[model samples]
Target: MTDRPDVLVVGAGPAGLTTALQACAHGASVRIVERRREPFRPSRAMIVHPRTLESLRPLGVVERLLRRGDPSPSARLHLGRRVVSTTLADVALRDTAFPHLTLLRQADVEQVLAEALEERGVPVERGVAAVGLAQDRAEATVTLRRDDGGAEPVSCGAVAGCDGQDSTVRRATGIDWRGRAYREEVVLADLDLDSDLDAGVLHVAAGRDGLVFLFALGEGAPWRLLATRPSRGGDAPFGQPGQPVPRPELRELLDVAGFDVAVGRVAWSARVRLQHRLAAAFRHGRVFLVGDAAHTHSPAAAQGMNTGILDAVNLGWKLPFAAHADEPDTMLDSYERERRPVARQVLALTHLVFFAEAAGHPAPAFLRGTVAPLLAPVVPSLTRPTLLAPVVRLLSQGWVRYRGSALSSERWAGGPGPRAGDRLPDETVTCDGMRTRLHRLTARPGVHVLLARDAEEVGASVVEDCPVSVHRLTSRPGRRMVAVRPDGHVGFRGTAVADLTAWLRLVGARARSADTATQPADTATQPADTATQAADTAET
Candidate 1:
């Protein structure tokens, strides 16, 4: 190992591991350290959204994750006496390669990422904790405390704080964490149920009391249960945090959830006190917070772990590029600008969903018991694959865009494809005389230029300018040239080869000129919601 790694990741969760993986893949020397001695731990997150799978695909671990997780399962929603069956399987997710949610344990995800790191020769230094940090103009010095009561300071070009809510790296930076805890506590468990519930179907019920979900995720246990237990004001008697849930309590919960199921055994259970919070800042000089250290919210839409993974992916590829950037901090600033707003949006969405579904107020109760039952009949029509396209696009986080960030500068007219800052949506194309998907080109390490026609015009100068690669698509022939970033985002799109050269140079690429040309940015950028536009015409 080198004395000073280009990047130092301070935790070993999905975010930290991903940061290490992506940074290393992009030619950055990396060292990942975790406080937990054990390589793996049980995780609260179980569902990996489609967008997350897309982000993880380039890392070469999605197949491993799919092997351990369940995908495209049907769902049976029970609203009072009405049972509305729907299929989450193959619901209008044509824009993505993995169109369904992957229900796997968080431990399984971390294990896969950790093993991927090991294969890359960057093992996680367990039992080492980042206790102190100091950054100068040159590099950051992190004081680490090992398990054997030894302490030392290591220097690095940048630091990634992917630790969870109570993150030492976040605390070391003294960033203000602002948010509140919900009075409600949710009891989540993996159990063996002696009931006729279909093992391949997810069951959800919302009564006047609250909402409960049961899924056959097969992570440790065959059945996973999430029941909302609203707080009864002050000093309310409830079972302990990690205690075994008794049979009577299970019966009461099942009755409240309108499920006629008998619990055979509880494989594992925990009473989770939900909280909502966001760091006032995601970056403190060279110390950047990620994952739960940056944001936390209820698992209403399952954004917790997925959001952190995206955070790591968004920042990972940028760290190496920023090191040689003309304005290094300017490049890094986009991390906070692009991510903080996403956290705010998630907090608001989860808060609204939590309040509507589980709040103690009678208004929400009326909505659940009376309003929901009346609307149950229309649920099937709403969940139809064609009708469900919008919801899938939104919840899968396929709609997230960085169009407003400093990095995304659109240079062409509203194209028939994704705009700058939007993810380079996966599409079928002819690459190297072989039928393959578009991601096969962008998945490799470096900036990829997709040329629909002329391959000779790109020249060797562009590739030599930076970590750039050129590909001439034998399909999707048009007057289009799109430059995909390392993180699978469309950094530039235009009709002119000269303009593509200018983009490479503007983004810290010292383009040695075969065609020294410059063009003004397409200032008339598309509207804020690029995903909606892409979904409408993504197939083109």
Candidate 2:
């Protein structure tokens, strides 16, 4: 009803809500639509990784999440009677503030995000579904169908398809959701257990039959139980997707798994078929695909929702700039280029975990009863924080970089710390008699410029001309200047003010004069439409 917003977000899940929140923070008017009249009551995605916590900090929802969620810093894997526990505290990266996984229900996560959106005066429009989409050079038109048999046409500068796997917007854009669904069916239930289980550690019980995972929801909430149906010839007993598992069958599975817990008060239950799929293209003209609409896979490492949240943050920061800029396509093109590769990497990782879980079913009885117990002590070392640094980095998503992105440039060499395209480390520093973290200063709505020692002598002119927050840190022993993008990734790093100014001008920074000597060296070859053309070619 508010005149067509600058962006239209389809679906009010975490991804859609995050997209809307970030777009609004960046000074863009946004409207979100969801087919459901009410918020989801059942919990879907539960584990909040450390990197996701960092991404959520800018939106002002990370503290709320931490307040409501329980911290899970370690995990215990039970192979028959043998137990192997590993703590994440030792392996947690030093640059990040959050060192452990937070466990909160999906519903709670969405509620917190919705409250934040409401505080900003952007309420989600419920009971409305985007049935069709079309776009031209100027704007995108979205066709909406209401539950009350009313249809409306809305126009906006861009459309963000944050809708789930069965995305209508993705279908309208003619992008293929390519992948195969796994044959194994997963059953999930939330219920109270009358047994002794540690609430701080994620408990996984593996046997010759199958695997069962127990995640403590919170203080009062029921525990979430996920089990893979034992293969008994062909097909699972659950008739269809979303079917509630019978109480008797649930008990039978627990009994078979050797758990001596009494199931009480089933709050909710569901059966789901996992899939590994990724859309061929994330953008089709003015409409962009995000979250599950862009990529979906097994929930092996709890990467689905975390990856989706990052996707929203990554695209959200760029939408407003692209919408209002003269050459908007350049900014829009980087969305796919930077995000698609991350999605591919996540899909591969989840697939690897899923197959590894499946491979554990055929272990001999002796391995489970005796040999597994003997190896349990050594198992923790195999996954120790020091030994598995690379794998842990991948799982935490801390190593995600945009080195190949058009928006990134590392022209200066011989830097001791982070480079362009790498995530800026969150270091603590004193500014104006107040101690603050680097991310706290740079995680605002615009670009951030950090000037180290001799900042006044190096990049004073560039800092004056650039429209970003300038922070001078005299305590650091270096002559370095770094510009961080809105999404917390370094855009440019160097010691010369002229080079910094040239790179800024190249990226559409406001320049005081046309004849500034800081213009890019390759300005002649790099046309404004070069990035746009490359994006077009890649999508096709």
Candidate 3:
């Protein structure tokens, strides 16, 4: 019914909405199309990991998410009659300001995000679905069909497919879905129970029948459920709510698990299998895919939504550059390279979860009984509250830093630099004596100015000609003068003003000039062998 926008998002879930918000925040126009008439009625995703909460900092949603969710301090695994392993969430991520996991319904979180998007002036368009997509070198033409059978075409500079598992965009682009599917069927229900279940722990029980996972939803509420079928699938469990429950089925599960129930109401129930899949590439020309469309893994670690939200955070900054800025085409490719490896690692973790009950493997049993519990005491020493933490930082904050493509040449130019796979910390800086978080300062899609004590060594003569801004590093300057990218990375390093100018010009190329044939590399030469070099390499 209307013309195209700067970008077209094919889903309105967390990933899609977050991508739209991030892109628009950087001044790019966007439109979102969703097949669903409305957001899901009840909450689905119940766990938001600490890493995800940290990622939400830049988006300004963590405080809100924490308010609406319950903090899960720990998790315990039971083997038959014994508590085999227990990992403290707080201790596991001890080095972070947000060290504890939050348990909130996906529905609630999605609703908050949707409302936030609208508040920021970008609303989700319900009752429309992407039926087809056509892309050229410059843009993606997305075709959407309305609920009433009307059709409209949108031509966007870029497209992000966050349309869940059965994504039409992924199929429309002919991208291969490469991953395994979980055969297990899980039955979930939200209920007001009668027992005194602790709100701080996620309890799991492994039995001959199947496994059951229980956690507190919030004040006076709890989520009780069982893996209806074997993780790999064989037979469905007893007590199918919509069907029938043997007299002993419900009572036995509750009695053993200590579910203090008093004839409560069942909010909703469903049977679904887990899936692990990823697109061959996140970007196909001008059409890019994110969240479930790009990667799907088992829900064991409860990382599906977390990873999806993170996908939004990752691509959120990149899409605007690819769609509106004069950035290089090679920069877009970095999305696939950086995120794919992460998805693969996430899948591997989910796979490790499957081994918890390997029938013939005694090693798994031993690990379940020993190594896991030991992790509790040692978790703290391994972590630190650094800027840009790692995925492994979940074990401890020390794993966080700006080490990969996430860094900018400015930071890599020998000033203070952020390591890849690390968390970006929001330090308070006084601009005109107005204090604000570093997160807010770098929000714009361009180079960041980080001035440090060592920056003077790089020599202002080399960077003075740069187009980016400069800030001097003072006491406790996170690092020396580092120029960060629009995606919250260091692009150039050193206090030298000339080097800053050159790096900015090198990275500020337009989308139209992204092709090698159009814009050749500048004489500035790439940042070599460091985080800045990697980030520049990511862009090239």
Best by lDDT: 1
TM-score (C-alpha, index-matched) for candidate 2: 0.86
**Model 1 lDDT tens row, 378-422:** 998888888777776777777788888777768777667899888
Worst ten-residue run, lDDT, model 1?
518-527
| For every candidate, C-alpha RMSD to the true structure in Å | 6.5, 8.9, 9.4
Model 2, 61-114: lDDT tens digits are 776787777764677888666677876554545566665566767788899999
**Candidate 1: C-alpha RMSD after superposition:** 6.5
Candidates ranked by lDDT:
1, 2, 3
Higher-lDDT candidate among 2 and 3? 2
Off-target runs (Cα >4 Å) in candidate 3 are: 72-89, 92-96, 199-201, 208-210, 218-222, 226-228, 231-264, 323-327, 357-392, 395-447, 453-471, 476-479, 486-488, 506-540
Poorest 10 consecutive residues of model 3 by lDDT?
Answer: 512-521
TM-scores, one per candidate? 0.88, 0.86, 0.75
Q: Whole-model Cα lDDT per candidate? A: 0.77, 0.73, 0.58
Q: Write the per-residue lDDT of candidate 3 for residues 1-540, one digit (tens) a residue.
A: 136687788898878887887776555677888998977644446777765755554455555676677663466555544453344334333333454556677777887778767877778899999998888887788888999999987888788899988889999989999877564545565655665556567777654444567776532235555443444343432112233333244546655543445536555555555666768888888888898888876566677788887777777666655442345664677677667777777777766766563222567646544554455554344433232145445422223233555323433433343532344554544433344335444433334455554444323222221123344434444434555554454455554656655554444422111121111112111211122222223322
* Candidate structures ordered by TM-score, highest first: 1, 2, 3
How big is the RMSD of model 3?
9.4
Judged by whole-model lDDT over C-alpha atoms, candidate 2 comes out at: 0.73
